[model samples]
Target: MNPAREENPTLLDGFRDGYSVHLDKFDGPLDLLLHLIRKNEVDICDIPIADITRQYLDYIKLMKVLNLDVAGDFLLMASTLLHIKSRMLLPPDDEEESEEEEGDPRAELVRRLLEYQQYKEAGMVIGARALLGREVFTRACPDPALSAARTEEGPLEVSLFELVDAFRALLARIPKESFHDVAPGDSLNIADCINEILSLLQDRDTLQFDELIKDELTSERVIVTFLALLELCRLKLIRIFQNGEYGAIWFIPAVAPEQAGSAGEAVQSPV
Candidate 1:
């Protein structure tokens, strides 16, 4: 009742929750009711109408006293709870009516609560899915010319993973040991592999991926070839394709003379 408190009213004027509360904080009537039910630790299906109704009205009174903007939805729910409580207090007109046949006054309210809870959970699930979608993103291919050319020619039917899987299958057939004398620290350089692949691709418009490496069965050579293919694809120098799923992959050369010339120039420069 303090005059100063009335001048600057708040929903938490007399409430003790260690923080301020406001009418806008609640989503709607059902949301507020659910909060009260949880606070009292009462079952939603078997709501204590008398106690809840009292608490509901107390908050309404507080809102009025504080001059807070109380939505019509809050008043509506208050009336509904009061009506259900009054019906429970009254006796049935016919004592002959069996308990099974008699409808419970709380049935409608329970149904609404259950329905709201279900939708609330569904909304959360949908929101979570949207959040996950935000975490994943696909970017357009960096080279516009290559992308345009590929589209004009035909879409690359095989994904990068599918091509890698095919290469892996081929690699498994090769023996671990090399045919010639073993060198302790010999390894194929990616640059050399790339140059070799480009040279072969220049001679032909398309080549079967397996045939490119068929002459070399060593694991090192196969891995280097696979890496070279990936590099070429990244550079837009070549594209891998297949007619169908699990089909033989073809390495189709991308017609990029300017880009290829630049790459060759860079590699040829004295390091």
Candidate 2:
């Protein structure tokens, strides 16, 4: 069989360009803003533009610092937020103030968010209904032999933003290190890092995200390894899970039988 790199040349190109973290599947900038709004427990219609903008920019900055690929849409949202913020700072005329909610700087954004939220929730309901059978039918009694493999329930699903938040917290607790480019070496390339992670996963069911990069003190190395973890997620060869809302995050090898069957075989990772 062809190596993963052969199957995913664009992913390899991403590596050469120093961007290996794929964020597209995690939703877009608007979704992120919604997440932030919900996180802060603030009213969506009355978003604190300045505070949310700062937090959003901070996330973007962290992604850059970690070498995670940031799409242009995120930057565009940042600018939009700034524009709204600037407009709000200006004193309003009686005519403008008398205007309906439409006159509010956040009016349009609030409308979009409310609409998008409804659509998202409706979509989730449909998706859950559609997959209900898969959830129920797939839970048939397991073989006595494979019973030891407790992954039948599968790993706890995690989101990209959660991973980012976890990484940010991880960085805060660690000692400061001078960030630099991670030179590709005999033992430090992403492909090797991927294999290292797979090897570690093989010994146990799950690994703490901290355990993967604890030895790699440099920011670049940690970033690259984290990207490797993201790559594994992209490939569906592993799963990232958090214990609870603010619990420890961990990684587990593929939960599917087909993927687990290949645990004994070499994985073809992007070179």
Candidate 3:
């Protein structure tokens, strides 16, 4: 045991004494393990089990002190590590011919750790990209489909869930054809629906509920169309309206050149 670690007791408690605590959050056991490995500047491919075991236990101890919820998965991993450490201490079985025949016990753990680290890094990159995309930017071309009042409201925003709902609606609208030899020659695509809605809004300026729905349209097409409309609204190209508590939904194109940057507006039909 390191005298310093013994003096500090808790894994993070040591940092409180003088050392800086850099990692504020960890996703799970793997994340915590990676943090410990990196902090100690230990090579992951050839982990020093004795050192890692001490540090891991210390962290677990700290978790107890903090009254943190100890998940079974974390405890399971700890047991696995301890078991590997114990196996390493035992002399090779007489039945085993050579050291090469008895593979390193830590091999599987090391491989998993490396793969998890890669995925974690990739997630961080993707998250950063999403954050960057959320930052508003000015567009060179002005959208003529948004209302002037709505255009003043700031750029429209839509959540990922809403986009998914729209997709589901589109999928539901698709017609089923039973003919084995006949593949339907034409069907509405999401992109095409988006473009279609934009064009409709551009020409009509406002669309009523009756005008928006087509009897020939499939359930999926309707949903895709709705999603496309939502997207357009997010882009500040359209505004939705309804009268009173429950009324027919109406979509109006934003007409101002500057209104293209306005916030999205949606009118939900009464249940």
Q: How high is the lDDT of residue 229 in model 3?
A: 71
lDDT of 3 by residue, 1-271 (tens): 6676665464666565676654346678898889889988989988998888778877776777567777887888899899989978987676673635446889989989999999999998987773322453335323222232233453343344544554465455556652233435557555566555555665665675445556545554466576667666666566666432233456667655234322222222110
Lowest summed lDDT window (length 10), candidate 2: 141-150
lDDT of 1 by residue, 1-271 (tens): 7664554343335453345555445678887788778888999989999888877776777677668788999999999998999888888546544635356788898889888888887888987773322554336644443444355465556787788799889878887556463744756777777777777766777788888778868877888788878877777777788744466798876766456646744542321
* Total backbone collisions for each predicted model: 0, 0, 16
lDDT of 1: 0.72
Task: Give candidate 2 misplaced runs (Cα > 4 Å).
Answer: 1-156, 180-187, 255-269
- Could you tell me which residue pairs clash in candidate 2? none
Which residue window of length 10 is worst by lDDT in model 3? Answer: 262-271
TM-score of each: 0.41, 0.39, 0.46
What does the lDDT read for residue 135 in candidate 3?
Answer: 56
Error of 2 at 115 (Å): 16
Q: Pick the candidate with the highest TM-score.
A: 3
**RMSD of model 3, in Å?**
14.7
